[model samples]
Target: MSYQRRLHPNLHMETDSQIKQPSGRWGQRTAYTKAPNITDILAELKLGHRVTPVFAHRSYTWELQKMLRARPRPVFDLCYLDGGHSWDVSALGVFLADRLIRPGGLLVLDDLDWSIATSPAFQEGPETLGQFSSDEQQAKPVRLLWEEVLPDLGYSHFAIHPNLGWAIARKRDTKAVVPAD
Candidate 1:
């Protein structure tokens, strides 16, 4: 996170190249203060040893490809796609997860069966869908994708039951099997 320069030809995420894993409790604070910001804290404590955290603030579009192309590293073992509850965004997340998640990795999907099917008459109240626009009203349930679509794409719901419409899917493992002579 140190500094994210939008989507570019490269990830453009370099923190003075000063990445290290300092053992201790990492706190959130400014750079000059005693506490370290989430960016530096994660860089040092989480991935400083041998990994990199590629964060994107914008939508998951073609920029994902550019980010992958720029960094040469092992596939991630876990990925949580928390974009909007629309089919387009969910589909895009699945597509990206397929490429970024390593075989046998876990891909958690949020907001399953969350259509919130209420008539427009009931779509009032500031606490409800009144805050969103027309497009947001079309936010459909994602369980259909997880149940009907993702299976065909080489992913399956984990053994654990999906909690509150949150599906835990694992990528199909493609491990190599050694044949005995």
Candidate 2:
């Protein structure tokens, strides 16, 4: 969620020479970090009268499963997956989101454009079928998988936020049939 950079002073100065003092904060103190912007989503959820936060990491699915299993039912009102950029990880995230989200819940995927629109492996083979053109392909599998999974999950309403490469998917209460006898 955050990144820090460090800078060191040059070591070419002579022992008797006066070294230039660094301005403002020094060393690690000068490092800066930023938090992801989730304020609007949090506010919207509050307005909708929902509480409880279910945080899941795409790369840490096992840990997530363990945590969710230890908790009560309807664990998450909204799930956002932005950890793993790989197809396998993203797909697993979608699957877990389906399991965790209650009827009428919401799910969000972050960095979708970067992951899907630039991965070489995803531009070929099983990852790419009939959905997008060669020039319009994305590197992440979620871009393609969501189309099939959302409807199957009974999410009737979905919207993509302009300019943020973020998408919001809403699960509906429509009865979904299992493909079995």
- The best candidate by TM-score is 1
Error of 2 at 51 (Å): 7.1
lDDT by residue for model 2 over 15-124, one digit each (tens)? 11111122322222111112212333345446434543333232356656675687464456787665455566667767776787877788876654555455444444
Candidate 2 Cα errors over 4 Å, as ranges: 1-32, 35-58, 116-138, 174-181
Count of clashes, each model: 0, 4
Worst 10 residues of 1 by lDDT: 12-21
The best candidate in terms of lDDT: 1
lDDT of 1: 0.57
Local distance difference test, per candidate? 0.57, 0.52
Candidate 1: residue 134 lDDT (0-100): 61
